[model samples]
Target: MAVDQGTFRRAVARFATGVCVVTSLEGRADHAMTVNSFTSVSLEPLLVLFCVEKEARFYDAVIDSGVWGVSILNPDQRPAASWLSNRGRPLVGQLDRIPHHRGPETGVALLDGAVATMECRTTAVHEAGDHDIVIGEVVGAAVPASGPADEAGALLWHRGAYSRI
Candidate 1:
């Protein structure tokens, strides 16, 4: 039997996951999006991966940029996450409203108050149904000086809701 989309979505939502903003810059164009599908792929090669909807505005920017940044949101970054995720919002103006800084290594913008951020160079891309799986090799990472090492204040997503870990 073929599983329906709602059934798959609801089932996957049961797994609580951290929130992150994936960002990229291609020449004068830049884009950011809230994502929860980010993951570590391998440590031996310092690899990571995140999936983006093929139709998302930021999708092509990420592909063309070849490098991207992942900002692991903290509890206080709920607004940033919400704003970036809204498909109706203007992509050009999204970053201007947030407290952010450009990654020194990749030039992709990183959210300022995130618990941690990482710069990754895209190593591979695969089309996965409605989304694109981007595999990257981590090149640099940073944590706030006072950020918690534990997951106490990490921003989490579950059952179509946002929560604190």
Candidate 2:
């Protein structure tokens, strides 16, 4: 039998995850949303992937722009994560209230205090259940000026809460 959604979610939460904000440009506006389902797929060509809910505004933006930025959050960037994750926040206003910089390669906005950032170009898209898995080729990457090279202290998601390890 299929597990209930809540049970599945809770079970999945047992696996600790790093939190990030995936950013992309939609027309002339910037779009971003908190995401934890990001993974590095390969190193040879430098591939990465993030999953976005089918209905999320960021999903469409990623598809339209064919590029996006991944901002790996630091422990101190919880407010940035909360703002991007909040569903009620207007999409167009997401970036206006935050201090961020546009990536040189993709022009996608990356949160200012992110521990690390990667600009990517979409290489493939696969639909799965209620979300879309977007795979990208990393075009550029760097750590924040104030961020440490060791990421053991990075912000993480576990049991529906944010934490640092």
Candidate 3:
């Protein structure tokens, strides 16, 4: 028997996952959304994937742009993560309140203080149930010159709320 959506979601919530902000550009406007579904797909091809609900506004922007940026959030960036995840947020100037710089490869906003950032070009898109899995080829990436410190943990999702570990 197929499990109900609620049961499936609740079960998955028990597994912790890191959070990331995926950004894309539509004309001069920037689009972003907080997602915990980002993952490294392959090392040989330098590929990564992030899942976005088909109806989300950022979905179309990323699909049309064909390029995007991923900012892996640090523990201190929880506020930015929460803000970007909100629905019905203003489309324009959304990144103004958050400190960011445009990625050299994709021109998408990459949040300041991120543990790591990647600029990627869409390699393939596959429809998954209610969401689309966007696989990208990593064109560029950055991390702090000193690298991530051991004590500086990542922002994570657990049991429907943000956590640090």
Candidate 4:
């Protein structure tokens, strides 16, 4: 059975995921992109995964780069996530405006006040659909500034919005 693209997209949008800004260094320049395709793959060795469009400018940055950071957005960070996700808008200039910290593992920018931080090393990249699923071995991790003990936050998407349970 073939699923219509629009229907499949809308269906997936209904299944909201945690929002995050995946970042890496492009020399002295930094690259950031909003992503909701993140998930924890394992606990023993500490692993995580996120999908990136094969055509994204930062796709290679994530793949070829040795390290990266995933800054899990707080509920209030939806706006920042939306902006970073926008391909129509340039991201380089806005990065300087936001206060950022570099992870000890990756030297990638971790969004200030993010709900959580996960630093990872690229482990594997598998081709899937129009995206590539990149898995990372967790190197360094942290709780967001003032984050709750249970660690609650909002979920975001390209279409609709939803609150975390």
Highest-TM-score candidate: 3
Q: Candidate 2 vs candidate 4: which has greater lDDT? A: 2
Residue 7 of model 3, lDDT score: 100
Worst 10 residues of 3 by lDDT: 144-153
TM-score of each candidate structure, all chains considered together: 0.94, 0.93, 0.96, 0.88
The top-ranked prediction according to lDDT is 3
- List all candidate RMSDs to the true structure: 1.6, 1.8, 1.4, 2.4
- Give one digit per residue, the lDDT tens place, for model 4 in 41-123: 99988999999999998797777776789988767676778778878677567577666899887788988878778899989
Candidate 3 residue runs with Cα over 4 Å from true position = 147-151
Model 2 residue 145 distance off true place after TM-score fit, in angstroms: 5.4
lDDT of 1 by residue, 23-115 (tens): 999897778999999999999999999999998888889998899999999888899999999987886667998988888998899988788
lDDT against the true structure, per candidate, is 0.91, 0.89, 0.94, 0.80
- TM-score for candidate 4, residues paired by index: 0.88
Ranking by lDDT: 3, 1, 2, 4
Candidate order (TM-score): 3, 1, 2, 4
Over 11-32, each residue of candidate 2 has an lDDT whose tens digit, in order, gives 9999999999999987899888
Candidate 3, 1-165: lDDT as tens digits:
999999999999999999999999988889999999999999999999999999999999999999999999999999999999999999988998999999998799999889899999999999999999999999999987665532477999999999998
lDDT of 2: 0.89
